[model samples]
Structure formats: C-alpha cells, structure tokens
Target chain A: DVKVTQSSRYLVKRTGEKVFLECVQDMDHENMFWYRQDPGLGLRLIYFSYDVKMKEKGDIPEGYSVSREKKERFSLILESASTNQTSMYLCASWTSIRDEQFFGPGTRLTVL
Target chain B: SQQGEEDPQALSIQEGENATMNCSYKTSINNLQWYRQNSGRGLVHLILIRSNEREKHSGRLRVTLDTSKKSSSLLITASRAADTASYFCATEIGSARQLTFGSGTQLTVLP
Candidate 1:
C-alpha cells in the first residue's frame, strides 16, 4: 500500500506569519500535488511538482509556493499567512500505473 | 478551471440501496477517477476509467465515462452505513501530471 504523510495534522498561525506544510510519500511517485479543500470550492490545486526542482502553478497559486528538493518530499509554503488562507490542505502522490492519487490525512490550517 | 463538477451536492439513502452520482467536465481527459473522503480524513481512491473506456467495475462500485460528452457517473450498489462519505471525481488530462478535482457529493447512508 502507498502511504502519503503530512507533517502536521493541524496548525495555527497569526496573520503575516510564514507557514509550511510538509508531505512525504513512501512510494517515490513522480507526481506530487498540494490542494486546499473547502466547502463549495472542492479541491483546488495550489501547486504541483512533477520532478525534483520542477514546479508548476495550479489554478489557485496566489500567496502560496511549493518546494520539491527530493523525490519523496514536497512542501507548501505560505509567504504571508492570512485569515483567508485558513482551510484544509491536502497532499497527494500519483504513479503511472493507476493515475489515481493517494492523499495525505490533510492539515487543517487556521490563520488568525 | 477545467475541473469536474458533480451533480447533487448532497444525497441521503437507506442502507442496502444504491446511490449514483454524476460528474461533468469541460475539456477532454485522459482518465477520470473517483475518490471517497470520510469526514476530516484523506481521500481514498475508488476507481479509475480511462478516456477510451466506457465503464468499469470494482467490487460493488461501477464507473462510466463518456469522453464525447465529458461526463462520468459513479454508482455504489448495496451501500452500507460505512459507505457514507463525500465522493469526488477527478480528471487527469493528457500529459498533465495533476488531476483536477470536482466539488464532491456528500452521501449519507441511513441505517
């Protein structure tokens, strides 16, 4: 079974503070993604990494960036956390076999 | 955004019954996938149907995809209380590594 693990299950930060959400996958998948899930908005992609040091902006990339220094780890960074950024963040990894992704348990972020 | 959009935002059904959800997208896709998410948990992959395939089945779950119409449907048969969760449809376009997801349909199976 594939396992995708997030660094934090929950987090709280003040406005304008820097925040980081980490994700690691044991399967060494080539595709990793970060998304924010909210009511009525579904899972909107924030950023994705296809390979180490290669990143692409998804539909919703404002105020957020990502890092993929290694194949197993992907990190989401908030340059300046705002109250509006508070939401459940999910990380996912995919391989070529199924094209279906395995997701992390998600981190509920609260930016006050 | 070329994301899939699911119909019927919420659904309630009695246990042992079947539940069907539909998803529509705006562009061509390489494959469509279904995922289930329990409250406050990560998503679990249910099934995947490629663009060339019309229907596929796994256990009690059935998925159908129509590339011309850019729509898909997922059916869960003999659903139990444990089957209750938010179901989402995701589409992976050709050459795109990321899957764009739809707003999920929340299903409640009553015991």
Candidate 2:
C-alpha cells in the first residue's frame, strides 16, 4: 500500500509567524504536491515537484512555497501565516508511470 | 480557475439507494478520476476512466466519461452509511502529469 504521511494533524500559529508542514511518501513516487482545501473552494494546488530539486507553482502559489530536497519527502512553507491562510493542507505523491495520486492525512492550520 | 465543476454540490440519500454525481470540465483530458474523502482526512482514489473509455466499473462504483462533452459521472450503487463522504472529480491534461480537482460533492447517506 502507498503511504503518505504529513507532519501535523493540526497546527496553531500567530500572524506573521512562519510555518512548515512536512510530508513524506513511502512509495518513492517522483511527483509530490501540496494543496489547500477551503470550505467552498475545494482543493487547490499550491506547489508541486516532479522530481527532487525541481518544483513548479500550481494555481494558488501565493503566500506559500515548497521544497523537495529528497525523493520521498516534500515540505510546504508558509512564509508569513495570516488569518486568511488558515485552512486544511494536503500533500500528495504520484509516480511517473501511474496517474493515481496518494494523499497524506491533511494538516489543519489555524492562524490566530 | 478550476478546470472541473461538479453538479449538485450536496447530495443526501437513504441507505440502499443509488447515488450519482456529475462532473464537467473545461478542457480536453487524458483521463478523469474520482476520489472520496471523509471529513478531516486524506482523499482516497476511487476509480479512473480514460478519455477514450465511455464507461468503467469497480465493485459498487461506476464511472462514465464523455470525451465529446468533456463530462463524467460517478454512480454509487446501494450506498450505505459508510459511503457518506465528499466525492471529487479530477482531470488530467496532456503531459502535465498533475490532476486538476473540482470542489467536490458532499454525500450524506442516512441509515
């Protein structure tokens, strides 16, 4: 089974604070993605990495960044957490040969 | 802008009933996929239907794709309370290798 694990299930941060959400996939997939889910907006990608050291911006990359130093781990960085930035963050990984994306159990961040 | 949009943002049904959700996308796609998510958890891949394929089935889940209309539908047969969850449709474009997801349909199955 493919397993994707996120560093936190819930997080609380003050405005202007930097936040880091970590994700690791055991399947060794080549592609890793970070997305945020809002009530009515659904899940929108913030950033994605096709391979280690290679990253691409997704639809909503503002106020967020990603790092993939190794193939199995991908991290999402919030430069400055704001109240509007509070939401459920999800991480996913997929292999080059397959289209299925396995997702980690999300991280719910609350900016206070 | 979101590439796909699912209809009937919310659906409620009784146990043992059939539930269907529709998804429409704005562009040509290599394939369309359906995923299920329980509240506050990760999304689970349900099924995938290629552009060329009109219909596909997995256990109680059935998916249909129409390349001409750029639309797809997922039907869950004999739904149970355990089937209550949010369903999303994802579209894969050429070479992007990334899936674009719609907001999702919230399903409620009552016993």
Best by lDDT: 2
Model 1 TM-score, all chains together:
0.97
lDDT against true structure, model 1:
0.94
- Model 1 chain A weakest lDDT span, ten residues long: A92-101
Question: What are the runs in model 1 whose C-alpha is more than 4 Å off?
Answer: none
lDDT of 2 by residue, A3-74 (tens): 999999999999999999999999989999999999878899999999999999999999998888999999
Task: Return the lDDT, model 1, position B56.
Answer: 100
Off by over 4 Å in 2: none
Model 2, B1-111: lDDT tens per residue?
Answer: 798899889999999999999999999999999999998899999999998899999999999998888899999999999999999999999999989999999999999
Give the per-residue lDDT digits (tens) of candidate 1, residues B1-51.
Answer: 747999889999999999999999998888899999999999999999998
Docking quality of model 2: it rates as: high
- Worst lDDT run of 10 residues, candidate 2 chain A, spans A92-101
lDDT tens digits by residue: candidate 1, A1-112: 9999999999999999999999999998999999999998899999998899999999999999999999999999999999999999999998877678999999999999
Report clashes for each candidate as comma-separated counts.
0, 0
